[model samples]
Target: GEREQVDFRTSHRRKDGTSYPVEVHLQYLQGENRRVFLAIVLDLTERVATERELQEAQRTLSTLLTNLPGMVYRCQNDQNWTMEFVSPSCQNLTGFSHEQFVETRQISYGETVMLQEDRQRVWQNVQEALKNRQPFQLSYRIRTAEGAVKWVWEQGCGIFSATGEVVRIEGYVVDITQQRALEDQLRKTERLAELGTLASGMAHEIGTPMNVILGRAELLMRKAPDERTRRGLETIVTQVERITKIMNQLLSFARKRPAERQGVNLEVVMLDVLDVLQERLGKQQIEVVKTVSPQLPKVWADPDHMNQVFLNLILNACQAMSDGGTLSLALHPIDDTVELIVQDSGSGIPEEQLSKIFDPFFSTKAVGEGTGLGLTVVHGILQEHQGAIRVTSVPGQGATFIVSLPIYSEEVRHEA
Candidate 1:
């Protein structure tokens, strides 16, 4: 038998639109007597293309999971701490890497959870689930790579082998930092509000007796023969009056009053407030600069409540400027509302603590120096008047508070 020259070729295209070079193989079946020629065509293009696409998808998914704000992980069921898989997010959540903890066994995942006494409770739950072949659910804090810690909730079922033996544990973890912080703040605020209510009740009950004592002391001072006795009685009477004022402020903040609205001239109210605090301002050397418009229209508010508002604000301004600075009071018309501005050249409020100034029982002053209800009472009073107040300050420069009230006209009231 003699063989003849033969040539064959084929073409194939990959998934990525790449063409593969053609190749052919020739073979003969020796068992058959005649020349039985066989040809085989090899096309590896499709398989190669599929593998490349799979790799690209995996890379994209890995990048996404790694940059996620939560932790993703996979662990084996063994007590020896074998890791089937761990995401790069483990570094952000638990201060360990996927490779370091999985392949090299450089860290223990369970040990890094939390060091508190409650950690034992978590371990006990995990042990019971593993022994009973049940799903595992746990939440705990974990130390992270940058020395930061975060809360994570893990819930996952065990993967079983063909024989029903547990094989692996896989789950996701989320950063609950913001949720926990809100919860803490809510608890604190609730406590403070409760304390404010109790303090208000106590102040009301004690105020009557304190006033009686103060009146008695004043009467006794006038009649005391010895100068030292008279001086001591005067001091006691002054302290009792101060305490009574603080209690009134607390009660105002804690309880709401049915507003007795009437035509109120803001300029007249400001003048009265200045008169009440004139002696105190003089003692503190706080200069009052009033720029109230004489022709300003009236506002609808309770006269007494409005007077208290001005007193609280002006007194606070005078107290703030301990080094003797200007206390500016200005009233101007803005659209349908009148704006009252009280500014002081004192040490300004800190930015971080400004938002809490209206919160009950929150104060920057030392204990006994303040009841922390001054601003809260002011806020409540303004709220009753259907007005709004805002504050702007810069540390070391000063603070400005603005109060806006709707203008009241005789025509509007008569029409109503």
Candidate 2:
């Protein structure tokens, strides 16, 4: 048989029935009067198609990484300079384009975006990583073009050369601005709440002595000798009493007393409060109107706490009508509860501030005239008593506060 030589372009079907173009190169060897053809077949179709698909996928991934809402970069070891690639998202993240950062056109990578205060620390960390050839992670703020600041977190590992030298650093930066803002706000709110609690506690502790001082001063004024001495004593006593009153208000707002859980006559309590404020009402020419239902049921609460509640509310009503208007106090029996309504013709609370009126230290009175804790104390006391309070007001018209206390029947009292 004689050896043959062949040259061919062939199509081969794969396991999937897809035909690929194959080209064969053959060589003839004729050393011992014998010939052999060495064929090298190249399958070009599948590889070309796979390369096209891979390129398409890379383009899609590139588009996604570039348009993301954060910065992505690859940097070299020297001075932490960015090299090779930077995503276009850099503009959105740091108010600078990829070009400005890469070639150090405006500033070096670390200098361009890192906050001034953070720049030194950031570079120090990078230096350490390069020295040890380890991963680096950092969180810092960046100022954007519009003068707004945003928080970013960057995490990356160093790429080492064959000799274990840090060749490059690659990382992703993410926007953590919103999370940082929320954390800041929560810290501030907690601080404010803590201060409010402290203020309330101090006011309560200071009020008791102030009340005693005012009472003693008032008794002393009655025994003073000369007219001048008597007048001076009266002034001292009056001022001390005013201070005591304000302190009491602060205490009420700050330390809400727990209900002592005693049987209370709602009608009788309201009447006593009215009696205590009678002189002031008469001097102010403010009329006191009362509507008490005789059949009102007894309530279980602390008598003194309830007294404070009625005193604060009724006094508030009287004060609102500085120009001398009618103060209406109404008591009625609602199926299982007693409703006490205090209404006045004085200037009502502003709509915008009504919701915050019960918040401690929130007041509409001139500085030194009010402590802003009256309503807050009232709210706390009512809550302790398992009661509820509500208010309605029209600016410049009037305000109404309604308090509801659970009525205790004989059966309920026995059960308790």
Worst 10 residues of 2 by lDDT: 250-259
Candidate 2 Cα lDDT to native: 0.78
Q: Which stretches of candidate 2 lie over 4 Å from their true place?
A: 1-233, 249-258, 410-416
Model 1 misplacement above 4 A: 1-204, 254-256, 293-295, 366-368, 409-416
Residue-by-residue lDDT tens digits, candidate 2, 1-416: 44456778788899999888887777676667566677888987877788899999999988998888877788776653655688888888877777777665664656555677787777788778768777888888777766776788888888888998777788888899899877865664565457557667777577777678777767777777778887887787777777776666554534544446777998888888888888999998998888988767788778888998998888778768878998988999887888999999988999888767776678877676566767777877887777999999998889999999878767656655
- Candidate 1, residue 253: CA error in Å? 3.6
Q: Report the lDDT of model 1 for residue 149.
A: 65
Question: lDDT tens digits, residues 137-190, model 1?
Answer: 877776676767677777766677898777777777777877887886687557
User: Positional deviation of 35 in candidate 2, in angstroms?
Assistant: 62
Candidate 2, residue 131: the lDDT equals 82
Clashes of each: 1, 0
Error of 2 at 302 (Å): 2.1
